[model samples]
Target: MTLEQLRALVSVVDHGGFRAASEALHKSQSAISIAIKNLEEELRVEIFEREGYRPLLTDHGKVLVQKARTVLSQARDLSDLAQHYAQGVEAELRIVVSEVFDIQEVLRALRIIRDQYPSTRLTLFVENFSAPLEILEDKEADIAMVAGGEMFDKIEMTRYEKLCPVSLIPVVSGCSREQKDASELTKEDLHGATQVVVTDRSRNRDERKYGILETSVPWRVNDFLTKKQIILSGLGWGRVPLHMIGDELASGDLVPLSSSDFGPVEIETYISRTTNHPFGPVAEAFWNLIIQRDYEKTNKITVKLQ
Candidate 1:
């Protein structure tokens, strides 16, 4: 019933007799006999037939020995896993990510972790802007995916490594800037229209602006998709990730701003550890995956505004 008893049984089967098992296991022969006796008494089965010079296993004894071998193998695996956990492997990891990442890249990382560390639990928190760092600093998250802007300036880069950059292409709804020629468009044209902005979802820190134009009136929203919906409604012009708005641009629901003079903004993304914080093995493995991801290059939003 116990692991010790199960191991004793397997050893006895492998070694041909109680005396041989005792020698193999470096235990007293009396102790081996007593363990086998206890196992038989507990299971109510005569395991060994003490018939001739060499002891032989009964039919039921053979079945139990096979079962005991499997159980003992699993027990050793459990012990190994326990040791692994004690050596900095975590039972769970928390990774907070910004809204603007390639879904495939995230899934690829998750799959690798699932395969490499099956027992480790992973929780993904999707937040926009500074919320990732807010979670990291407050000790809620072990790793954070943050935008590389003034947010990096607030935190020391010694604690972080560069991950990837997400392209934020400034685009307008098809209805806006109809009068301006694409090449001649300038700051004056953009200033004449309302600019949509997505607010940082951080509760702990003051929100910082990335690509907000100073001259235009700002329409602030909480989520990226909502901001996209607003811009699609011709509410305002705003920056969107090139990948997210590809279908919109293809279908003529949206187009890049008619401003050759306007900047092509790219939000530098980073995989940052909380300052002075130690990450578990699972989180570190995840961090490596982010670093190794060969991201497709970010292209500018040059979709002709029609």
Candidate 2:
């Protein structure tokens, strides 16, 4: 079948109806119907059966569609690679990362790429981890750095060494460091303290449930650095990554109100993309740099202020 026919088939399966698929593909509804009919005839099977008013895929059709998705995804990647290749630079690599990663470290890596492969281009998109995964699925990003260990049928992950585990330590400014003890500190101790959380809408439900809340007033901040500043200024006590505030903690600018471990939050790093598409030279080269040396080693700094 032609690539257009395969594309039409995949779109119908994805959008779940010929009319919806037509609208999405910007083709007339009749054209979509004709494509599906042509596909069914070639395959000699009823791809769709009427179920109530909506068309449902036959069992055989479901199997065909599954394969069709991979075919279409790979075809699109081939087209993208070709277009990028024609542009004549080494290649283009697109990546997405979370704010939790040190931005400076990411910039340094790009600088090295520029010095080594002067013709190559690197595009970086920064967002929460979930958004990066979405980009990978849509094929918008060549590679994405996201939270690791979960497997999806369409995405493949290559593990990078674990960066520092984030510990959600509680902090309060102006609270007598002398009285610092986790067990002695209770929710009542946070009664008047303002609690700030980094604006991560997709954070685990357990994080929200276990979070310190002020029955009186709760503050939500969008920027992690700003949130840390607010906490250090003693506006309120909230969870801050231990690594991010090492200098402040050491300098007494920020103090852990309680010594109790809030437990380590595992944030494994990964480079992920669709398994069906092979990485072009640029994507491969950039990923190689990420794996060549441990990110933590290059990015590690004394968080504790002297």
Candidate 3:
């Protein structure tokens, strides 16, 4: 009936006995027992079978405990939301990052943010293709690190900062049957081979099959790392980010596959956020950090050019 009673019930169920629950809740054993007795009487149900060595929830008690947990969770969320508004700091910040973007830079930024805003919770979702954009549009993410292309133009962004262009090179395993140089291989040469592709994670969007040949059999994967591993095993050929496969290409573990039909694709990456919603303090700090980093990189490039 009350939050205290609910907490006492849940604690008793979780901690195994009245004594343990009292100890965990910092309440006397008598008080815990009294709370449970009052709750059972009010509900007109036996919450625990007294015959057992350890306290066990009765059938009805199990159902009530589940409901109590939901109520408790919602109550905590409400409290946190109030605290967030009062303090001007987000209770949680969600970021959806495209897998193609180098995660090392993002991780470093997050490490700094974690230390700066210890009260704000951070949730990172690594998705592929159009999923990051979709998540941002749906208000499921506070920010998105997406590869800018035609799909990115569809969304209206309040703030965005461009990063470096990512090069996607079509590659095959060095042990593959086709050993000719990349330029010598034609579209026809790769038509019969299996092409590994990362599936779009968006739910409703009509997925575009980039660089896929009509004649080639396509193998779909959810992430790029798996796709890269499949291509490295000689099971299939696929285009992966140059950053991810630099060592492999240098060591000749993976061979580049280019032809008149498909050679390499380049796309710009952006850190974007929508204007529909205002950012809390933590989110604002993170956005500023990303922009500062971009500015620093640009100044370095300009100095070198000068």
* Candidate 2, 1-306: lDDT as tens digits: 777888888888778788999999999999998998998899899988976577888899899988888787778878876876676444667888766666665676777778877876678888664557767777877777764334333346432334443355667664544235543567665666567876655422113333656462668776568888887666666766566787887887776656343333446556666655566666666677766544546354443432
Q: Write the per-residue lDDT of candidate 1 for residues 186-283, one digit (tens) a residue.
A: 77767757888888656645455666878989988887789899888878878887778989988877877645567567787888885445566788
Please list all clashing residue pairs in model 3, or write none if there are none: none
RMSD of each: 19.4, 6.1, 9.2
- What is candidate 3's local distance difference test score? 0.83
Highest lDDT, which number? 3
As for candidate 1, its clashing pairs are: none
Clashes of each: 0, 5, 0
User: lDDT score, residue 87, model 3?
Assistant: 76
lDDT of 3 by residue, 1-306 (tens): 898999999999989999999999999999999999999999999989989799889999999999998788567656656766787878789999989888887887888899988888888999887788888876678898887555666766546778766778999998877745655787887777899998876764536566788878999898889999999898988899988999999988899876677778887778888765667888888888877886787699789999
Predicted structure 2: lDDT = 0.67
Which ten residues in a row are the worst by lDDT in model 2?
201-210
